[model samples]
Target: MKRPEDIAEQFQEAWNSHEMTALAALFCADASFVNRFGHYVRGVQEIVALHAPIHETIYSDSTMQNEVISTIALGDDAAVLHCWSRLNIGKAHPAGPHSVDTVILAVLRLLPNGWRIQALENVTLTNPRTGQPVLRT
Candidate 1:
């Protein structure tokens, strides 16, 4: 099983590469997700469905910068992870639609495949940018 610390970078890498399949694989079948917009959904299928469109739009050219704030074990099969990330919207550059310090709390379980995320909830720590929400290419 991959340790929580080891798999953290994979998530950001998957997002940066825009590989939906790789991104979804990080979660278990019953996994749940809550995006930055505050919308919540259950099941890995739903999580991927919700992300697909967004990744094709605002998050299409985004890259993730993850920082693991903490990790606590829950028994033998699960662990709770708290982290923060900056979704560098569009090509990296000077101030634009900065994704104000997003925070995430995820529950991961030791599944047959690997350590898969079971439930992940995220919140935008601050409001969206005033005029621009994302930089264009």
Candidate 2:
């Protein structure tokens, strides 16, 4: 919360901890998010709702590592950034143990409390020719 660039680390921590409240606290009340699967939702409550179930189900044993790709300051109160995230999924889910790489684009605003994400979109890395998911190098 000290810096906008730190959001990626915070997200990774929250996700790994499986704490939806902690994750929701990182976003603005009216925040918008689009998951790698193309599901879109607006507002922190909706965001929490969208993620909470998954944490207990498909993503129960998932851990994520996020690396900041770039951060651009839009102004004193706003910024945009991309984070490369690698997710290690556990075998508890139906898909079995697997890994996924995604690029997350986030727009953050300097709220009164601290920096909060206003919008975020996650896209899975895929091979263009094969149209299949690709692991990050």
Per-candidate TM-score against the hidden true structure: 0.83, 0.98
**Candidate 1: segments with Cα more than 4 A from true spot:** 91-97, 127-137
Cα lDDT tens digits for candidate 1, 1-137: 47875556878888888888988889888888888787889887888899888788777777888888899999878899888777777644344555545778888998777788988887766426663333222
lDDT of 2 by residue, 1-74 (tens): 98998999999999999999899999999999999999999999999999999999999999999999999999
List pairs with backbone clashes in candidate 2.
none
Model 1: which residue pairs collide?
Answer: none
lDDT of candidate 1 vs native? 0.78
Top-scoring candidate (TM-score): 2
| Candidate 1 displacement at residue 104 in angstroms | 0.8
Off by over 4 Å in 2: none
Poorest 10 consecutive residues by lDDT, candidate 2: 87-96
